[model samples]
Target: AQEVHCLAHGLAHCAMFCAISGNAPEHPVISTKSGHLFEQSVVEKYIESTGKCPVTGEPLEAADLLPVKVASTVKPRPLAATSIPGMLSLFQTEWDALMLETHSLKQQLETVRQELGHALYNHDAACRVIARLIKERDDARQALAEAQPSAAVAAAAVAAASAPPTSKGGEPAAKRAKAAAPAVESSAGELTPEIIASFEATSKTLSKGRKKRQPPADQTSAEALAAFGEVASEAVLPAGPVCVDVHASEPLAAAGGADGSVILFDCAKGAVGAKLAGHSKRVNAVRLHPSKPLALTCSQDKSARIWNTDGTQLHVLSHSGDVTGVTLHATGDYCVTSCSDKSWSLFDIDRGSCVLRVPDGSGGYTCAGFHPDGLILGTGVDSVVRIWDVKSQQNVASFEGHTGTVTCLAFSENGYYLATGSADTTVKMWDLRKLKNFHTIEPGAAVGGLAFDNSGLFLAVGSADTSVYDTKTWGTIKSFASGAAVSGVGFGRSAATLAATSADGILKLYGSSS
Candidate 1:
């Protein structure tokens, strides 16, 4: 009975444990033998009181409480191993996200670096440009500073050199001497002052004795000559021919005869030496070469003839229209002629051909001449004088001042001055160096001819009134009325005799001490 009770108690306790743990009956709890006996005895006592089974509600019995042996089978939960993989996948995803962010940051950093590099390059270039500019500015400043003193010193030196020397009294010596000189001559001559005074009272009568008288109307040449009282014999003669050692010295006297012949007189001999007679019409102009034996004569027949001193015709230049004037080169190798056709042509003696033709597009040409250097040629067309370069064959300058036709021109020996005579009764002196007009001498009548002395100290101008001018001050030294309206004037080679031609077919000569 105790064994039955003990079995019942063990069965009850096992059933209770299994029920609390929710274990299967086949997986029941096992204990030691002593503990099982204690449990069985407890269970038997309880069962007798209740008379019921604790499990299954069958009946209280020791046989029914027998221990059943079951196999130990326990399966793991589904997908238990997959938890670790899922966790690993989550970690891998997080790592990928972090890597992506890092890459994006790196890309941004690279972009920023590239931008910075570009900006740095631009800044460097700007800095270099600025540096170059600064350096250039500094160099310019240094050059200016270095040049300032030299410029100032040079200017000051020029001023000093140009300043006139001062005297102790602050007056020029020349001025003082001029003021002290006597205005009247001393009475020391053999002719007493009283005699001189008496002579001066009849001076008008004496002057009238030399006056030209008009010939009887319709008088013949013989009658006129007889009445004129040997006027040709009374004419003054130059000392002799002054042969200048210089080559091609220009003739002092160039005259055109009524017979259409051109004659060049030796300025020193006062004698006719050469006659040029190539023109079929009246010769209007004649000029000797500045430094050669060649002569150029323009005629009303619309042509100019180049001739040798021996009267040999070298060339007969025909123009499209009437030739008015002709001038020879200093070397006598070239010549220029102005025509009423409003054109001028340059002739080369060596080539025997017209090298250039210039049209006076504005007006008709009246006169022309070569400059002293022979490189510049000047042409007077109406009231304007045009200068041209022969080598370049170009017009260089034009001078406009004359109111009427410019008829005559003379260049100074030094090549620094030029003189022109116009039909406006004015003579102008031009400074070639300065390219400016220097002086104007109004002779009160149409100026027909002009000539400068070899020394360039005096100028002879022929008009209705023949006059001599002091070149230094442009002052008229003397003026003598010609018997007839003068057509030409020239200085003799000695610079002492002045010869003039008039419309009356008379050639008059005047002597001067100064």
Candidate 2:
């Protein structure tokens, strides 16, 4: 059933109110030209009272009323204000709320923007701080790098200036002072601080000779030539002794006579141990084994004789031509001999056989030396020192700085450096690590023999005036006038006894007369 409401009138037809209540068929209706419905009794009452229709106010009688016709069979439920007008009012209220929320969100967004800007500012400041710190660190490092060298140089200069005028026993006081002078112009200014330090350290250390071996207590003088004793050669060597060696480990010493004789001497007592006679010609070179009781001698007789320390002959090595020089390997298992035939031969001692023979194609080989390791050989030719790798049978390195025939070659104990002496009166120090000559010294005479001490600290070069130099600085540590041209120079195993063989037949011994 449809709910009826009185909109304009209190009592109306049976039909639903057209304005207030929607049209429904289940409601009884009474309508006329006004298109409204009312109850039949209400119309009759209205006609009896006012004699007109309620809506239209037209004159109407009860008998003239007609019922409105509807097609729907069931009555519709009553509805509240759910129409377009009501929806429009609700939409207006929702639109106002949405506007308020948008305004609040805009305010929050602005606040977030301000906070983000502050955070960005802080990040930028932190970045700047980090950049500044990095720059400062780099600057400090650069400053330190620049200051260390200057400080080191200044300290070195001060120390040198404060040093005493007299040297302990090496270079002359004036020469040392001149060499150590910081302002003495040279190539040092072109080198780095580290390189300069290296050069300076070498100079300082070399200027001070071995302080380890104190002179004998009985000795009172630092004389240059205090001959301990002399060993006389047999039969009066006509051409003088050509080569000499001293066994520092023992009190034994040997000298090769010009008449192809080797004279052994007991250095401590200054007595003759034995006299070896084998070759028919002059002995050119002789070397005693470092630890063994064996000695090797090469002669112009085209033979090299290996002798026991007791002067007994062990083996004989025959060469194709006059043997000029011979040196044994540190191990005593091998030896190298240089001959006038422009060839150098490597011999196995125990096997008594030649292992390899390398010919100097350009010039006659004058001297041969074996490295400490016995893996390489050095041969001196005209103006060049050729280094051969024994295993590969190939020349590994060649040094050429000498203007005359290369006469002598000596390897340092470490086997990393080589000292080559030439007849041009120059000795060049070659560093094998770089395969180049590092330094050169003029000995003022034809270099006959070169020897590096067992410790590799001192290098003795035999010339007109025998000169001993510190290996590191290549500085002349001491100079001894041999009275005659020095033919050979060597230090004993202990490096305390220095022997120099000159044209004079007498074997000169230099040491403290303990």
Q: Which candidate leads in lDDT?
A: 2
TM-score of 1: 0.49
Across 354-428, the per-residue lDDT of candidate 2 in tens digits comes to 766766555677888876555557777677777665443345555666788887889886556788888888888
Span of ten consecutive residues with least summed lDDT in model 2 = 175-184
Candidate 2, overall lDDT?
0.67
When summed lDDT is taken over every stretch of 10 residues in candidate 1, the lowest stretch is 175-184
lDDT of 1 at 139: 67
Clashes of each: 6, 6
Query: For residues 1-514, could you state the per-residue lDDT of candidate 1 as single tens digits?
Result: 4665565555655533443234444434322232222234445555577765544344555543445344455756446345988767777988999999999999999999999999999999999999999999986765554333223323433444455666669844320101111111221113335433443344334223313333234322222211221112112212211111111334345567545666656654546666666676666677666556666778788888877878888888888887877776655566778888767777776556776666645667777776554555667867766665544334454566778888788776445667888988888777654445778888888877777765556678888867777667777777767766667676544354566776665556565322
After superposition, the stretches of candidate 2 with alpha carbons farther than 4 Å from their true spots are 1-236
lDDT of each: 0.59, 0.67
